[model samples]
Target: MTLLKAKSILSKDFRIGRASDRLFGSFVEHMGSVVYNGIYEPDHEAADEDGFRKDVLELVRELKLSVVRYPGGNFSSGYNWEDGVGPKERRPVKLDLAWRQVEPNSFGLDEFMRWTGKVGADAIMTVNLGTRGIDEARNLLEYCNFPGGSQYSDLRRSHGVRDPYKIKTWCLGNELDGEWQIARKTADEYGRLACETAKAMKWVDPDIELVAVGSSARHMPTFPEWDRTVLMHTYEHVEQLSLHHYIGKRENDTPTFLAMPLEMEQQIKDVIATCDYVQSVKRSSKRMKLSFDEWNVWREPDVPYTPWQTGCPYDWVKFHMEDALVFGSALLSILRHADRIDIACQSLLVNTIPMILTNKGGAAWRNPTFYPFLHASRYGRGEVLRLETESPKYDTKLYTDVAKVDSVAVWNEEKGELTVFAVNRSEESIAYELDIRDFGNVSFAEHLVMNHERLDAVNTADNQGEVRPRAGGTTTLNGGRAESVLPPYSWNVVRFNVQSA
Candidate 1:
């Protein structure tokens, strides 16, 4: 009977909250082929009129991304925002130590803004809190958002941008604690600098929002202390505290790797406590949120580093099938924490550990992770509903046997539908029956599954259709529950027409 069974959840009210309120966004850095060929492939057939790849743009648009963090991951630590502002031909070339690549200075601030505009998203710009300090940050703010007057604003106008970008979201720094990070600073140093910088940047544009650096990851030895100290210094000055965490499937065990999102839940919980603690200590009622700026299932098997080698830092790293499954779990985890995680960007947008990868002079394809992101971003809006599932488990050395079922339900108040994204990590398929008590009656539309036989299957530019999310089957129901078979190692999205249900 395929071990199918029904589990009645008596008080099964949907854990309804805004998923978009939690948000889905991505970052794009200057390293690797992310530039030059990734997002800016001029010679490709898919290239748009502005030189941005049309194929990649369509994929990004499909991801339903609300925000796009610009021009830096680690790149911001060393970037000087002014170099690429004026006439393109007059810009000066410089060395970008973050990625060990030469800065052509062709695709600068203006280009990035235009790209964000084309992508139908808002820009989340990062300030160089490293080598360049407050004055540089303020100048960039005035240049992008200031209307006129002063040298920088006038230079922006002379550059033909009559209007200021006025980007309101700003990141104070990117991973300031890492030794590899350019101009890394001590917690105290970063704290003082952040406070002063936030204060000054606000002076330039008070409407702008600021984020302070949280620990690079939870395991960082300085962790809670770093967060406490930074918040102590800058809590009152900033609106959000940024956290960056990345997971990997290095174990080669699908179940354990899929368990990562649940683990991330714990880490996010800790960060939340830390923030509340700081808020309590400072005796401030104003709540602060989290920005998970860098995240995703990155498959960088190994790092072969030759200090400042004469080559790009990221050469040809791309994501595969299983990686995307893990990515779905990560997005599910983000939904679970929708209330506190105010801003989240999928590590990157194009190339350099991106959600979308492109090849110059050829077509580009969506990474295996793209479908999950696309499905959820397009439908994971409105109120997020909490789901409860029970299944058999498997044990691994790192983490014990985990539940085979994981799910996040989104109730789109705007569209009046419910999308239940479930990741069945079990090796064997399981037919499950669900009853959503909140929706007394509704119709199930589709059950799309992102699955394939080989764990390593990938999408290439030539055979882009080799892997993708295809239309799923669903019951034309007039009932109170939803039923579906969640395939092994797959992510499933069950869409329900629950407008008034």
Candidate 2:
């Protein structure tokens, strides 16, 4: 194997932008066991007075999630928010056509908001524009944000929430470009509805922000066009555009899978260009940012599961050690584009391709992909510093000019700390060096690395500690230069604290 070498230089003065706290967000949809047995299980031994799972809530807090998008992915397209508001005993068990599961309607608007409070995270509500329209969107906004003296606000009072939830961000719809969605529409169709709905929603609560739907994926036939058209119509009405993409692998191409971040980077760049072009065409003063509402590693089984049933448990995606590496790379991609993409959510939070997996009535465990997210959320706050990198390059079957090492640096000025998140994508162990500028009396804080002997090794509920991050030894800062050996296919976080020289 050829020796791989990589070097990166970062400075506190050269920064991308102040990282948005909302960038560390996750999603929760009413699909699979994500709702019923995942987060809220009254019968579970770990349940609290409010029936929310204490175990899951603790893990969620540990992840340091800033915001959570609620109620649906595809489920929102067909969801009737009204059906879920009343008492649980009276609430009917409705069939969720999106996932073919039965939504008990037991956990509705109030319950989710309550859970958000318990987890200490804000909410980003997504409205139904597929089966519903502007009227319903306006009503939901009024019910959630309006204080009193109105019918919807009074209805919220009747539902036991005297204070309004005051949700700030709202999604017009989810994945209108995909055929899998209910009442899917063309770009023009979704644009018109989204524009009209956004206007009416702002008419109800002008202070709130809106996210218009973009393409479901870059591979979609109408990706750039969809983004262009949607922005052309709703650019002046909305504050952000929504994008969703899930990385998956087949036939065991580990190198290709690890390099998937390149693809994500391209997609983000294309969308940014499209947004800018639209701004120039309309001569609009406002610039559109992105909300990556759904993203994760989804691997399909050799044989697809047959016979989907209501309330039946399903394990959609079980992540391995390699997936964590890719997950780290994905976060780095988002950090690189932190200037424009302000918000992101890592798909489902519980079961069915979740960061944390639960054992129904038993225990909850963090998957391999959880640690990278944890480290990013904890140390990756503050301003993102730009890095000048010199790394070995290679080519994969699908991706060319691939960097053997990928990395991002975040400088927390308030805490006087700097964090460098790096990934060694090459098959051979590489010597990595980082040079710091304009800093004084810096000391190496911690070097945390996530690596496994087997790339596909996983942690189960019984053996939850099997695949976890461990200390990757220590580093010494000599004149602001730190060096370490990045193991082959490893995710490393090197942290340093600054002091007076």
Candidate 3:
């Protein structure tokens, strides 16, 4: 009889307790339905008394989003804050060059703040470092943070918001390294502009936090140089050095593909080192952190950009299952380094590669990738525990000798629960023993699993329930340990309870 060798994982090492848990922070932008129908569909049946969709709000709360980046991805670079404020009736209609849509100006600045308040999440505002600069940024600070008698603050008062928005975290720009970015600037030009703009903004609201743009991607030809140049020039001017990284499933191979997340793990280390290097060069005591502003799974080959002649409003691309798995991997990486990355936005919150998407007006449903995002945000807080696991390597086109299962566990100290988030990207079903050694006096709780029949499965307006989360199977609890069954191509979160002995 042939004997099957168990996928043995020895739980023996205790490395660094945690890196960071900023995976809680996600992003939202005003492109496509993200603003129009994604969150603010006036025609939705589930909209609340304030015209905000109750279904979406409930979902966001369920996801337990900590921070939602607002206003723009590329859209902010060209946005006019004044145009969006004041009486809606008197608001001017303008062209949205970034998304190629008509900016009705009805749902601008104040409307977003109102929605943020409704969702019960902190706001991360990105300034227009691209088209507009210092003056507009200062006015925005006044409008959102300053007290009475000021022009912008008075405008905020006239608009019915008596209290200031006081959004503490702010981003300087979105993907300024890419030439495709609206009003793209050279590194030198951007550095000077950001320096000036940040100085002026700090003068307005000294307490506010600022993020300077980093490289769009390390793979870009002008990478480390762009990052160094920008940081060298703007690090002292801001609190956080922004880093934007995205991963996509271009290759059909799952093994190497799942390794993308760990690649990002290395990415953050490099970014931290970069921040330190620049800080050392300046001999500055102020330690700058990272704001991973924009990140997600975007493969240009998968979703071919619609020609502008077709009037494709702002690169609107829906997400897929494999893409979501890659996203899951990305979250694990971010959680692993939460210490240096205090503030991070998930690029966008809706429709355009959005974590949550809505269709049929106000009726929202979870995307296949949404479950990983939901689980990570919901359970991934407190000090992250460095879990030790061993999975056989799978060779693929993108990465060599990548582990089949990618997982990260977060221990919510307050709740006394150890949440293990695992992803099995192997082609065959496998089970692994989860050894909770040394630390005992606990029991297994609920295990939530999200898996679909096909890798390409997705949710749509007509059939939103096609790729949702469901139970995988019963979990096994042993002496201070548990055994988990990981189905092929699945993402699962297991909850464990450990009481004081």
Candidate closest to the true structure, highest TM-score = 2
Residue-level lDDT of model 2, residues 332-358, one tens digit each, is 989888899889998878877789888
Q: Per model, state how many residue pairs clash.
A: 6, 0, 8
Off by over 4 Å in 3: 1-22, 299-318, 360-362, 472-474
List model 1 lDDT by residue over 233-339, tens digit each: 99999988988778866666766787776667778888899999999998999888888888877777223433343223363555777778878888888888887
TM-score for each prediction?
Answer: 0.94, 0.97, 0.91
Per-residue lDDT of 356 in model 2: 86
Tens-digit per-residue lDDT, 58-95, candidate 3: 87787776778878778888888889888889999888
Candidate 1, TM-score vs. the true structure?
0.94
Query: Could you tell me how far off, in angstroms, the CA of residue 473 lies in candidate 2 after the best superposition?
Result: 2.6
Clashing pairs in 2: none
Candidate 3 weakest lDDT stretch, 10 residues: 3-12
Model 2 off-target regions past 4 Å? Answer: 1-3, 301-310, 472-474
RMSD per candidate (Å) reads 2.4, 1.6, 3.0
Q: Per lDDT, what order, best first?
A: 2, 1, 3
